[model samples]
Target: MPFRKFLGWFKGFFGKKKIIRLGLYGPPNAGKTTLANKISMDWTGEPVGKVSEVPHETREVQKKEKVTVKVGGKTIVMNLLDMPGISTKIDFEEFLQYGFSAEDAKQRAKEATKGVIEAIKWLENVDTALVIMDSTRDPYTQVNITIIGNLEARNIPIIIVANKIDLPESNTKWIEEAFPQHPVINVSGLTGSNVNDLYSAIAKYSK
Candidate 1:
């Protein structure tokens, strides 16, 4: 293993009070950053990254360290990792709809591709993963399957987040049915609905 990866493993395995490396992972525009920002701002008084209508707006992993969350007299200190949105493919043409120039579109596609690789690599470093899914969209996608498979293969704890429950078309039940084995929390990161339930889940399940 690389020195950095080894160090991460060492700390997670042996450190006292082990600051859980909580990773936020999901498909593009699935509200990963929005939830991350909500968590960070609630605990650290800071936001993780910018929210955007554009896919891959968070083209890099954002970290907030030493965030202390307390629930029911129990406290969990963690390093929150806000990961880039994962996608099966990146097409430059997709950016054109957002009014991007040809050159910028291609550049964004390249960066998004790289971001996917980086997010996958960071999987090895995460202790717990929150798989955020857009409650308004179908949950049975290759991207979601791939992410869950990778995390499960590594024996990492998984919490399925049914985000955007505030939307009229949102069907959090569909997501719960899709991944019944994992714990699912319905939340609307944008409106902060049921977010307390998310925090309680994080406190309960994060390792």
Candidate 2:
């Protein structure tokens, strides 16, 4: 009994799992919040953030911590970060199309610009990043390249998620071709399609 107890203690000491800070980053309405919500709800039985059709809906850095996720029978503790939508330029006029008043639109734009800066600053804190991309759109955007380039410079682990794969317009091939350096997981955050694959990839790649 004593020997077994000592062995168990040794294993427990050596087998301590590290909590990975996983950031979900993408452009406007690309489903970063949705994916973060899915992951958080799947593991924690709760959501991390709200989803909206409006651009810059998530105008802040949202975090959900101590989420225990199971992937391929392996349990992982994760701190999920849902970052704001990043764009090369944010115009208040764009919000006018969404029926927002000029003042409200301008305020949202200001907050969104700040959110982008915060997301970039938080890159230093990310252990691994899941760069979410809209599968239906062109993948060769300055935002996507900038996000990937920054992650590359920091030597951070990246898992690109081609979100909205359930949409008929989605072409995962384009995203794959655009980012050949990292593994891409196709998922639909809205429909919860192929989310298991995402979990498996997270477990496999996120160190």
Candidate 3:
């Protein structure tokens, strides 16, 4: 390789690319934490937050710092912010199905509402956002549209993750049609399918 090209590549490898806060935002049970865990584990040998079947399992914004990701021979440093699920309404009755007492459920509901606010406030600090959507669910919901609109209005770099592609009913194409202007990577966070594609997209577009 030529010396100049080598130097450029070396700079890309070692030179300071300002670290970015890459946030994950989506509705409840859309695999935000699952994807965060996958990426964090791959790079840092750790998971950012626990995953649960119950909705609003992650009732807080969880952050993992200094995670370095390499894609297509280029590396980028990021602080992964796994934001809590965004919902317009939170009712304690929803938690009853999870076997929580009425009091416990109410408390959880309160925290979850707070989490939604924190997630939105954290958006001001995020340089890029991964709008995660469940591929198996309809992508035209108010929550999904609202999040994307907020990010677009701010001109934030956005990548739509059509997660859970491993499921039989997962339809990534629907997401493409929903938001034709943005790039979407289809993957299964639970099974690790096509996650490398997501990494490459992050490297290519998030910069």
**Candidate 3 residue-wise lDDT, 135-159, digit = tens:** 9999999999999999999888899
6-114 per-residue lDDT for model 1 (tens digits): 7767886785466889999999999999999999988989998999999999998999999999887878899999999998889999999999999999999999999
TM-score (all chains, Cα) for each model:
0.92, 0.92, 0.92
Clashing pairs in 1: none
Q: List where candidate 1 sits over 4 angstroms from the true fold.
A: 1-15
Q: lDDT of each prediction vs. the true structure?
A: 0.92, 0.92, 0.92
Worst 10 residues of 1 by lDDT: 8-17
Candidate 2 clash pair list: none
User: How much does candidate 1 score in TM-score?
Assistant: 0.92
